[model samples]
Target: MKRILCTTALTVGALIAALGLPAGAAQADSTPRIDLRVLVVSDGGPSTDAIAAELDTAGTPYTEIDLTAADRPVIDAELLADTVDGRPRAKYQAVVLPSDNPFAANSTEMAALVAYEQTYGIPQVDAYTYARPEAGLQYPDYSGSLDGVRAEVTDAGRAGPFGYLDGSVPFEDNSPSVGESYAYLAQPAAGADFTAYVDAAVPGTSQRGSLVGEYRHDGRRELVVTFVYNQYQQQFRLLARGIVEWMTGGVHLGASRNYFAVHVDDVFAADDRWNSELNCTPGDVDCPDGAGTPDPIRMVPDDVDHAVDWQEDHDFTLDMAYNGAGSVDHREDHNGVDHLTDKLVADRSRFRWINHTYTHAFLGCEQDTTVVPWRCATETDGSVRWVGRTAVVDEIATNRAWGESVGLPLENDELVTGEHSGLKVLPQQPDDNPNLAPALTDTGIAWLASDNSRDPRQRQVGPATTVPRYPMNVFYNAGRAAEQVDEYNWIYTSRAQGGSGICEDYPETSTCLAEPLDTATGYAEYIVPLETATALGHVLSNDPKPHFIHQSNLAEDRIAYPVLNGVLDGYDALFAANTPVVNLRMKAIGTELQRRAAWQGALRDGRVTAYRVGGTVTVEAPDGVAVTATMPTGTTLAGTAFGEAYAGERSGWTPSHGAPLTLALPSSAAQATGTAEPASATDPAPATRVPEGTREYTAAH
Candidate 1:
């Protein structure tokens, strides 16, 4: 009979109680029992953090066991007999050893753990490595120094572990401070499964070495990896995440291919009348007295055509949000409508059209209570009130109607408010704006774009799902040119004072003729961080979406064009190097966003719990909360989460894996409910407040 040495004082009764299972829930002794335990054996190093980070990113629940704890003694024969869950073999599906030479300093502990591992047959991952004869882990070649080598993935490597790669991935030398490095250069042992190899020759020799290798020991899979966890390279992070997935026998839930969508807001027909305005202020240095007017040679429909052609040439799609003020006329150049709309209609396949709102209304206000009633009429009532239920409905309908009238279909059904004016409700709560729910539902717009980090609660408002953009688009508010310039300068140059490098020429006075807008500066200040965020899976929104640009960017001699070009150039450069980045239109991304939001809501609402049993993973939602997950091929899915009929059943052949499958209980109809308590006049605006109305707005309508 096996004895249980209970750490954390958890008994079968305790676990059953904690899991809310009935007293008789445990199956008969002869039944195969599945467990969700992953043993993390670490000395509290970066490798440990790296493992934890990937687990967190995947939303996988895990319990960490620290090896370097001062109070805990080293492993001995007695402890090994009762190690972890106290089964003769530890009751864990997998084990993560932070270092390659896990038994380096402590031979006794190492031998004890090694015996337990061989008996248990649990798969293991060794994240760090070094030559250790005592541990029987050796690098025979013994380069004796870390190599600045490029890491290339092998064919088996792609299929065995990482869900991220279909082809090879390279970790290139990015910076002097933290060059691409492999800690140990070792030859693969005989019959070992070598997964990855370093391309660089070991010091003064025409011989490269294995960077990652795997093999079986005692009927268990063992993976050896080499990559500095703290180097903070995007590729390193990606690999680390993939390794965790491999260890846990799980795959990422959604998005088979890596892609990004670009959302261009305030896309009106070419506005030749309004040129790119030059910032001429009262500041002592750069301004010519009262010389603010700019030449009217602004972007036209032809410019938009050229830009679209450029994107098409590069095989990319764009999402354009239009405010329906422009009309199309067929009579000569005197057509009452904007030609851009006509051009967009002609080039429908290249773009996805979005409704921006009729006439770019302000949807929020400052310090106004009951100012924008939901049933207001007229711009004064709407703007003064700063967003009411009626105004929001009207804004969305009017703009959508305009798009249809201009022969451009509003197929996306996504609304980005003109000016991103938040909907200041008749009754505002500090945490939620339940009032906007009805307006959103009435407009039939399921996806809404916001600015200034809106929707901190990450909850849906009625029928509307709000998506927020961050880091502020350069042309979001054209009037704030000086502020935008200053911010960019600080971001680009490492200078203590915020000045663009152009000021180097103006030695006596720190002034330039105009704000700096160049590709090189823009790439460093804006595009690189954006790309980094995308690669890390946290761009403007919580997940990777397109970097937002504006229609105004297409204007000749405008800041938008150069910045947009820089973004595309960076994207192209990365793509050329074989990094997977799909350039998609917003319509596709918005649909995906809706699915992601719904899935996120299910998790946050505490309605679902996911865990694994044996080789089968189970998703439990006792409250009939819909449960949906995207699991890889080969795994079987069943139970109430799949369907009541399939409860306690197995999926017949693995259900085809695709986008994240959403399991959701039916939602109740949205009500025109007031907040539990309205926000006090003195209180700061609620985070979900739309980006309109405030003077510091950072979104284009």
Candidate 2:
């Protein structure tokens, strides 16, 4: 019996040795504290820049080392990690390199990075790299332009990082002549531990090659991407989230969502129609004087009904920026009753309403239209004469009062001035009217809309904060498709092409049209796709800025619907049900921007500290600041489920309120480690075990 007992003890000791654990160890060890920051090594390339942009947009903190900089910091083991209070601590949760190997082969810097990643059990991302044996891939079977290719997310990918997608990722082919995308298609190297995440069929072949995959070798893991792309490309935007999640293990210091909102300006008002015959509007500034009668475009009762139905069908709401003075003028002209106003008022609850002032008055410096192209009016002393405060107050108050009288739901804090006036206008009024700020404060306005084309940054105007809005190219003066196409051609075509030469003079901002567009099909074919692409870019960029169009586009032929529909449909095709378009009201959008600004400032100032140890995450921030994070579904805050679930993860902003925010993660949560086990030979890799030494230290400490 003594010999048998000794044999049992000896067997147990051998088992522990095989598992790489100390004697009497019962389980794998816990990971050391890993800081929630990314390290980016850039070569000034577009692919690296694109990833950095994604990190910035999500409010994720990162330290970038430029390869071209003369005084760039060196990569070393000491820089990557150190001991904190007798415990090993990793300084970065992930590393992003310009390529798989940016340094010389077998260089100390490269060896240091590999050792750091292996020691911390952290992942590395190769932003863009070629298909070669060094990257654990066979030479390219097919290489060159990837434009118009339709790639697929593998089943393994669907179960892993790329699951947010519903399989298909179509590359854009904007112009036939330009090679917009390029990639190399290759298979995994023989006997390599590689798992393809995103792939496409090699040209003229039945076998598929990996475009994105994971390569595990020499106790380190890397996310290898074999394509060239920039920040603006649709394909890159679609895959950026997955890439970030894979690098950071879906536990990071920031969150992202797709947002879109539309504001229809000049509601209940008339817009001057473009004159195709005279090549400009018959207004005071640029047309032949008295060339034709002024014909304005206004929405009819039928148009109001169609708008409500369209909103219901699309599950979206439009913010109608109305000028109550237009209804007052119509009432006086039609014996004090107007059908369009009555229809809109009866269905007022169907849409959001913003105070657009009493009339569409230019609230900037008084205009001097005596000379062509207009200028600011001057005082007797040659000083700039400004519009007074009373005029601005009346415009805001009268519109609010009018809306209330009609039982229209309104928020007094939101305001969009006529033509975004009372603010600066280039070349004519270079400064805001001195009266605008005081008027806004008196009227209790908190959020004011500014044209992104002119003022793209949010700024203070007394008690009010500016909310920059995108101006849709759907012209305010256009009421019909043919009229819209005619004006677009007039603005974009060259003077030699019998149109304005503005595109030639300002090539940076405007691209001259190849030729005149056909008025019959141009609005539907050319203009709609171009505008839709631009708007979609904003939505995918985590931007919350609202887009503004004129009520005239919803009148007459209702030309704006096609572009709006294109944007909606295109988004649906690209994203899965887990990710929905976040449509926010003006106030809500303003608040989101405000929070982002504060959070980004906090990150920039190094006031935020976040990390994960074992099954718990901790975040610290200054008082009144909010913390944003994306974590696993089972993560909890203060004993309750945390964040709204989207794209297979939970993410939201939690107010710190001058306290530490601690999250309790479930037992199944992925834990960081000092060293991880090799991936298995399977389609989906298994979670690696934490090294035993760290766990023993954690147990002791």
Q: Which one is best on TM-score?
A: 2
> Each model's TM-score, in the order given?
0.64, 0.91
Candidate 2: residue pairs that collide: none
lDDT of 2: 0.83
lDDT of 2 at 212: 94
Best by lDDT: 2
Tell me the alpha-carbon RMSD of every candidate.
Answer: 13.7, 8.1
TM-score of model 2 vs. true structure: 0.91
